[model samples]
Target chain A: MPLTKRIIPCLDVKDGKVVKGTAFVNLRDMGDPVALAARYAAQGADELLFLDITATIQERKIFLSLIKSVARQVNIPFTVGGGISSEADAYNLLSAGADKISVNSAAVKEPALVSKLAKRFGSQCVVLAADAGMQADGNWQVYVNGGRKNTGISVLCWIEQAVQMGAGEILLTSINNDGGRKGFALSLLQEVTARVQVPVIASGGAGSLQHFADVFEQTGADAALAAGIFHEESITIPQVKQYLYKQKIPVRL
Target chain B: MKLVIVDYSAGNTCSVIFALNRLGIAPVISADAAEIRAADKVILPGVGAAGSAMLSLQQNGLDNVLRSLQQPMLGICLGMQLLCTASDEDDASCLDILGGQVQKLDAPKIPHIGWNDVYDLRGDLFKGLPENSYLYFVHSYGVPVSRATIATAAYGQSFSAAVQKDNFYGVQFHPEKSGDNGLLILKNFLNL
Candidate 1:
C-alpha cells in the first residue's frame, strides 16, 4: 500500500515570532512565524506545528489571534498547542484555523479530559503531548505545565493512557536532545512507537537530515518534528525529503 | 479562477504549493469556511495521523464546509485519507465523504517510503500522463483499492494510487516531486 511519509517543520512561537534554542530556554528570535510558515509551505513541508512556548497560563487569547492570523495566510494544515486547557479552549483554537489541538499539562491534570475532547470532537483532534525528561532510573518521566513540573507517571504509560482515553496522536519530545543536535533518542522512540497504535511524531534532537531518516527507519515513527534545524534554515523540508529519497526511504521527493 | 490549497492540517501542503508555484501557478492557501468554498479549484494536502487530521477538520468546522463545496477538490496523501469513512491511523473515524478505510501497510518495512508509479491513469489529474507513471511516495498507511480508485500503484501490495469521486479526487503519489509528470498533473487538476 502507498503511505506518504510526513516532513513537518516546527515553529516555537513567542509573541508571534518563530524562536529557537537548546533545552527549551534561552530562546532567540528566528523570524515572523506567518512568513516562515508560508516559506515552509512553499518549500514542500508536509505540515507545520506551532508551539506556543510562551503561552503561559496567563497569556492565551493572544495566542489564539496569532493562530488565527497564521491560519489565514497558509493553505496547508497547522497544529497549535501550549496552554490549551478546556474543551472550549481547544474549540477556539480549532475555530481559529488550528487543524489539531494538542493537550499536555491539561491532560495530566485531568486525565479524563482527553476522552472528553475525543468524544466531543472525535479522537482524531486530540493530541497527547508527552514531554519526557530522563530520570536517574532510566525511565522517560512525563512533565507538564510547560515542563516546569514533573508528573510521576512514566511517559510511556501516560501516552498509553492518553491513547486509551482517546488521543489520536502522540507528539513525544526528548528533553535531553531538544535542540542539542545530538539527534533523537531512538531508544525512547523505539519504546513509545512499539506500544502506540497512533501516529507518533518524534520531536527534539534533530540536527541533520539523516536524523530524520534515522528516526523513521530506526524508531518506526510516522513523522519527524524539529524546530531549530528548520527555524535556522539549517535544513529545508525538501532537502530532508530528498535526503530520505536518496536513502531509499520513500518521501515525496 | 485560481488554484486553492485547502489549509486543513491533514498533512504537508507546502510541497503542492511549491510544486504549483514552480509550474507557474500562484495558488491560494485557505482554511476559512468561506474562502475555500469560493476558490476555483481546491487541493487538500495532508500528512501525520489520519484521525487527528479529521479532528482538525471538524474542530475547525471544515468537514461540512468541504463536503458542501461545488469546486473541484483534490485530496493528497492523508488529505486523501480524510475523504474516506475511516482509517486505521490512530484508529480514526474519517469524514465518510468517500466510503473507504485508510489501512496501514504493515509490511516488513512498516512505513513504505520510496518512489512508485501510478500504473494506469483514468482521471483528469493524469490526463496527459502515460500508464505506470512514476511519482514520489512515502507513507506507511493507504486507502484500500475501492470504487473510488481510478489509478493503481505497487509497493509491497497493489492499492488505490489515485481516486476520483464526484468533484473530489485523490492522489497517492506526490506529483510535485515527480518532475514533468507532476507539473502536468497540477495543470490538469487546475484546469479540471
Candidate 2:
C-alpha cells in the first residue's frame, strides 16, 4: 500500500492540562494531557500534537515536563507547538521527547528562525503551523497569536516562503472552520496542498467521518487533524480510519 | 539485555530510550565506543541529514567502532541510511555495512511521513509480525531495495523498509514511534 493518510488528534493544552475551545476560546478542561495521549495512542492515532494555547515563558517548564511524561508512555510520535520562539525552545522540546516542534507566530515574526531550525535539525523536525482566515477580497489572510491578529499576508505566499525556508510539513488550520465542526475548509486546503510538495495536514471543521473523507478526497491533504471531535468522542480515530478505508482512502488500520 | 542506543547527537535518542523503557529495558544512551561495544544489543538511532549525522559519528569515532561491532546492531531512519555504502543526501560516505546506496526518494512528496505497510519480510527482525504490517516513516531519502533488504515499502517506488546482513540490521521506519507493531520490531531485535 502507499503511504496511509494520517489521522492526528490534537490536544490544545493550557498551563499543563488538555483543553479545547471553540474557535480558540471559552476553553473547557478535557483531562490530563498524558492520559489523553495514552488513550489516543491506544486508539491507533497516527500522531498526536499538543498546542500550548497559553504558552508563557514561565509555563515552558510545565509544558516540557508534560512532554517528557507523555513521551515516556505514548509509543507513537507526537509534536509540541505554540510559543516556540527560538532555537533553544525548539531544542528543549525535542530533547524533552517531542518528535517534532511546530512554529507559528514566532516564525511569522522571524522567518529566519525557520531556516535556522531546519538547518540545525532536519527539515522533518520543523512543522509550520499556519492559521488562516478568509478575507473580504476572497483571499485567505494569515492570522497569528491564536488567530487574534491578521498579518494581512496572503496564506499562499506565506506558506510558499516558509517551505522555501525549510519547513518539512504544513499544519494548516482554517480559523473560520476551526471548532465549528461543519466540515474542513476544502477550497483553502485544496489550494495549499496543490501549491506545496510537502505533506499538508488539514485542520479544523471535522464534524463526521464523511467530513474526514471529504477533506482527503477533495483536497491533496496528506492528513486531517481534529481536536473537539475526538475529545468529545463523537467519532474515534479507528472509526475514521475504517470509514476512510471503505471509501478507498488509504489509512493505517 | 544490556542494550545501548548509539547517540552521536543525531536526534531522537530520547524517544528510542523511552520506547525501550516501556518494554522494561533501560537502554544506555552513549557515544563511547567501549560502552556500545559491551552491550548485548546496540541500536543506532538517528534523525537528521546524512552528511551531518555521518560527520558526528566520525567525530566521535563511532563510524569505525560501529563498522567493527559484532553484536546485533540495528539502525533506524537516518541511522539505517548510514549503514549503506553512501548517501545522496549530502554526498556522504556511509559505514558500508550493508550493500546499497541511500538515494533521494523519487516521489511527488519529498519526506514521506506517516504510516505505511512493510511487506516481503525476511528475517527474525519481523519474527511474529504479519506481512504488510504498518510502520511510521518520516524521511526525504531512502535506500532502494537491494540484496540486503529483508522487507520493502513503497512511497513513489519500493524502497528498503528493513535490511539485514549477518549481525547488522537496519530499518528506515522509526520503530520507536510506530506504535505497538514498531515496539514488537524492537523487541524482536532485542531478542536477537
Top candidate (TM-score): 2
lDDT of 1 at B73: 88
- For model 1, residues B134-179, the per-residue Cα lDDT tens digits are 5656566888888888988876688888888899888876666555
lDDT tens digits by residue: candidate 2, A1-253 = 8889999999998888889999988999999999999999999899999998887777878888999999999989898899999999998999999999999999999999999999998999899999999998789999999999999999999999999999999999999999999999999999999999999999999998999999999999999999988988989999999999999999988
TM-score of 1: 0.69
For model 2 the local lDDT of residue B157 reads 93
Poorest stretch of ten by lDDT in candidate 1 chain B:
B106-115
What TM-score quantifies how close candidate 2 is to the native fold? 0.99
Instruction: State which docking tier applies to candidate 2.
Output: high
Q: Rate the local accuracy (lDDT) of all candidates.
A: 0.78, 0.92
Model 2 chain A worst lDDT run, 10 consecutive residues = A53-62
What proportion of true contacts does candidate 2 retain? Answer: 0.81
Tens-digit per-residue lDDT, A1-253, candidate 1: 2445677889888876788877888889998888898888778776678989876655576677777677656655567888778888887787676767788898898999899887666565577889999999898899877676887889988998998888877899998888788889899999999998877888989898889889988986888898788877778788898898888776654
